[model samples]
Target: MVTRRWWQKLYHRSGSSTAAAASTRTISPIMYEFEHLYQMAMEEIGYAIDSQTSSYYAYDLEDAQAAVQACIQLYNQLPITDKWNPWAEALQQLQTRLDALPLPIN
Candidate 1:
């Protein structure tokens, strides 16, 4: 079942008694979240994969992996509409790299 968010409820509320009005969600905020997640994972994982900084190892590798997982979850939860196709495609690279990481040490 598709659950509605509080913002969705608020957006749907209107005094004009036309039953329901169509709405278009602006692209900036949606892109912002995706970009933010990408930047965070990139900050932590980018150096590890980049040959130039591979030697600069850190213990937070697991954290970076987790961030990527969050991104993937967010992407899955997002509605797969025509307008969202581009953003979904942009995230595929991040998902692929995140998938190939070695399992975290115990």
Candidate 2:
């Protein structure tokens, strides 16, 4: 079995920590609420795709794909104005940790 990198473990650990913290602390209730709304929006998008595919509506499929892509692009564009933009910060930390590891030379 292959071993996972330290950064991978760190990423997972950080996510777990954030989830736990979010659950206990209600400082940003609106942000937490938005998370639930965002999840529901994603689920609706998935349902749209399924409906389009099952109905074999070419236009509907294309529209659904475009909507999903737009949503993803918008998500990627979210500004990380501070050092604690959780997702971006976590990803950057993971990359830094991964890069610090020495690779085995063949």
Candidate 3:
């Protein structure tokens, strides 16, 4: 008989769904909202970052940037896992644009 802790699950030799479970710290609503906002930004930042196309609007960039800043503040408290890094990097870089002014994307 064996009793394994949750941390053991990630690297155990068994094929249990518990191995896929994450040992994440509980987060406040801010983290949830920040992730939601960052996801929204990913959609909008694409238009402004690469193409500077009219598909993304100024209001969208502004709103998303604000959200990203807030997201970073909250995310900073947690361990930077693979789950958060990708979008976190995108949102972090979204501010590098030369122009953050609102534009009316057609």
Candidate 4:
């Protein structure tokens, strides 16, 4: 089950100061949390991409696939925005690379 994040809890809490600050501030807590999570997801995606492309070392396909799946999950949890465009592109590229790999017959 997906649990609510700290920002969600904060946003939902009664009589919260963040609600007021969010309205007046240019960068709301929600945006801050989104950016933080986006950065983390991007980092994980980058690592998987890099490891797969590097010529010096062998990387685990399962691990890279897992990382991509995790990033996709995080992306799905976040709100809709053009900010996610890059992530969508990166995910596509990573998926393409993964798809090129030969599958083992069961």
Candidate 5:
């Protein structure tokens, strides 16, 4: 089962602060688009897991995980042109947390 502590860390590290700043400071359209894409990718990963595709097939799990990792890597690599780019930093933190999680045993 998912733990509250994990969720809390994820929420904080995934740039809730950056999003708030963006709303309060009139962030650019391009930054907003990046945020939207990041959110969509996260939602897709959740949906895939919820649908049991990952558990029913080993390849599905690997593919989904790889997709998420790729997105996170891309976000972390984006140039920090403005305050909105803090999302990239946040993505890096999230990726580190995910990497630290223990793998499930077969």
Candidate 6:
């Protein structure tokens, strides 16, 4: 008889019901909340980037700035140990786009 590793039970293999049950385990409430907020921030960032790239006459720099600020706020709210460091790259890209926009002369 072959002994299975503990981690292997979480994956679907050999049509085992145990794998399905393990995989369906509920996520922690904190993680769920973080995921929801992160998605909203990403959508806002995506919209801002799209607006900046398009040739629309009514592009609002303030909206883009707000979107980046929202994401930063979200990042700051997370605990240090729970931080998703990879997300910093997305923030950096959005900042680059905002910086590239020309300032309006008053």
Scored by lDDT, the top model is: 1
lDDT of 6 by residue, 19-97 (tens): 4644686755454445544454455445555665555412345544554565567667777666665766766765776
What lDDT does each candidate get?
0.53, 0.41, 0.48, 0.50, 0.52, 0.51
lDDT of each residue in 1-106, candidate 1, tens digit only: 1112222432364546322221234444444455555666666566445533343333445555666676667666655562366666767777777666655434
Candidate 2 per-residue lDDT, tens place, 22-106, comes to 8786645444433433343344345444554354344333433343343344445544442246644544443343334333222
Cα-based TM-score, every candidate: 0.49, 0.31, 0.36, 0.41, 0.41, 0.47
**Model 5 alpha-carbon drift over 4 Å, by segment:** 1-25, 53-79, 83-86, 93-106
**Model 6: ten consecutive residues of lowest lDDT:** 1-10
Candidate 1 residue-pair clash tally: 0
Q: Give candidate 3 misplaced runs (Cα > 4 Å).
A: 1-35, 47-56, 79-92, 97-106
Candidate 4: residue pairs that collide: none
Off by over 4 Å in 4: 1-59, 104-106
| Model 2 regions more than 4 Å off | 1-27, 54-106
Clashes of each: 0, 0, 1, 0, 0, 0
Worst 10 residues of 4 by lDDT: 1-10
Tens digits of per-residue lDDT for model 4 on 1-106? 1122323432464555545656665764555555444444444445445555554113334444554565566656666753467767876776676666544222
The best candidate by TM-score is: 1
Candidate 5: clashing residue pairs, number: 0
Q: Against the correct fold, how does model 5 do in TM-score?
A: 0.41
Of models 3 and 4, which has the larger TM-score? 4
lDDT of 3 at 90: 65
Prediction 4 global C-alpha lDDT: 0.50
Q: Across residues 5-65, which tens digit of lDDT does each residue of candidate 5 receive?
A: 2234344655776668677867566555556546644653454455453453333334345
| CA lDDT, candidate 1, residue 29 | 49
